[model samples]
Target: MILFFGTRPGKTVITQLPDTACPYCNQIGTLQVSKTSSYFHLFWIKLFKITTDTIAECSHCKRVYYENEFTEAMRKELP
Candidate 1:
């Protein structure tokens, strides 16, 4: 249920496709993205955009990744 960060209907637990990466440690295994939300208003409410919490985590390092923030991107570089 690969949950896209800052998407609609809230978060969905992802499984079956195999673990991707730590998004922190860059290690691939049992890494999961969590249920969190942010905002983007097109034709809707008052708030145009706001940042909530959509963190990807590294079970190893226990670091929280905020949407594609610094730690998340660095995962790819890990060996």
Candidate 2:
């Protein structure tokens, strides 16, 4: 799935992902795949597989959101 790993303005660089516990998966690796940041106008999107970034598919919910997104939310929630 394509994830926003912090932007450089115009690019939406996407890394790849797989269906396993990220820590246990290890079946994937880093490969850079990107898109136009303009597309982010959609609040949520089904990211394109570019490379893995510690992201794993939930066996139950099967919902995918960036781990970074969750972390950022928690950081904001803390304050």
Candidate 3:
């Protein structure tokens, strides 16, 4: 028999910051905050979360950035 074990990244859109502008695209009301988790999986079944992080993205430019890269105003806007 063979067993498969590996890790994958899962992402959830926490909230939309309609008031914030995307730094990369310079687009207004396009920034969104998302939570990402890395987890181990067995046979494609998720086991447990290994790590987590928050990110900000621009719908217009498809730019992704970590929470620490967000400005004070942008950070406060996250849910």
Candidate 4:
């Protein structure tokens, strides 16, 4: 018998931050937050979620910020 199991990324959820400025570009209302979940799968079927990651991106500068790189203002806007 053979088995196939692995982990895959789930759908991404995006949220717009109003009145929020990008930490790097300093552009207001251009910051968007994206949340993604990783799930464990067995035989192409998702079994359970492993972890979730949050990130912020600047539409102006195109910079991506991870959770560890989030600022105080950015943290407050997270849901």
Candidate 5:
């Protein structure tokens, strides 16, 4: 018998951060937050979520900010 199991990334949820500016670009209202969840799968079937990652991107300058790079203003906008 053979088994196929691995981890896969789930759908991404995007939300706009109102009254927030990009930390790198300093552009207001151009910051969008994306949340992605990883899940364990067995034979192409999702079993359970492994972890969730949060990131912020600037539409103007296209800067990506990871969880550890978030600023005080960025943290407050997350749900």
Candidate 6:
């Protein structure tokens, strides 16, 4: 029998953050909080989640930031 298994990432938009200064693009209101989870897949179907990650996305410059890079204020804003 042939078995197929792999890992996949699942993402969720936590929230649309309010207008805030973007360190990368120096823009306001262009950042959104998102959550991503890595999952194990079996036969092309998701089996169980392995790990999770939180990040921020900038619409202007299209930059992605991990949770460790988030400022104190930004951390508080996460949902």
TM-score of each: 0.39, 0.21, 0.64, 0.87, 0.88, 0.70
What shift in Å separates residue 44 of candidate 3 from its native position after superposition?
2.7
What is the lDDT, from 0 to 100, of the residue 42 in candidate 6? 94
lDDT of each: 0.49, 0.35, 0.85, 0.92, 0.92, 0.84
Q: Model 6, range 1-79, lDDT digits (tens) per residue?
A: 9999999988665777785767887888888988888999999899999989888988889999898899776777666
> Predicted candidate 2: what Cα RMSD to the true structure?
14.1
The superposed Cα distance between candidate 1 and the true structure at residue 63, in angstroms, equals 1.2
Models sorted by lDDT, best on top: 5, 4, 3, 6, 1, 2
lDDT of 4: 0.92
Model 6 residue runs over 4 Å out of place are 23-28, 60-63
State the lDDT of candidate 1 residue by residue for 17-45, as single tens digits: 13466544567674555644456544443
- Which consecutive 10 residues in model 5 have the weakest lDDT in total? 18-27
Clashing pairs in 1: 1-14
Model 5 lDDT per residue over 3-76, tens place: 99999999999999978988777889998899999999999999999999998889999999999999998898
lDDT of 2 by residue, 1-79 (tens): 7644421234444544332222332333322223333322223553343433333243344444444633332233221
Candidate 4 weakest ten by summed lDDT:
17-26
lDDT string for model 3 (1-79, tens) is: 9999999998665788888888777798888788878999999999999988888888899999897799877977765
Error of 4 at 25 (Å): 2.2
Q: Which candidate is the best by lDDT?
A: 5
RMSD values for the candidates in order, in angstroms, are 10.3, 14.1, 2.8, 1.2, 1.2, 2.5
For candidate 1, give the lDDT: 0.49
Candidate 4 per-residue C-alpha lDDT over 1-79 given as tens digits, one digit per residue, 9 for 90 to 100: 9999999999999999888888787899998899999999999999999999998889999999999998898888778
Give candidate 2's error at residue 28 in angstroms.
8.6
- Model 1 misplaced regions, further than 4 Å: 1-17, 37-52, 70-79
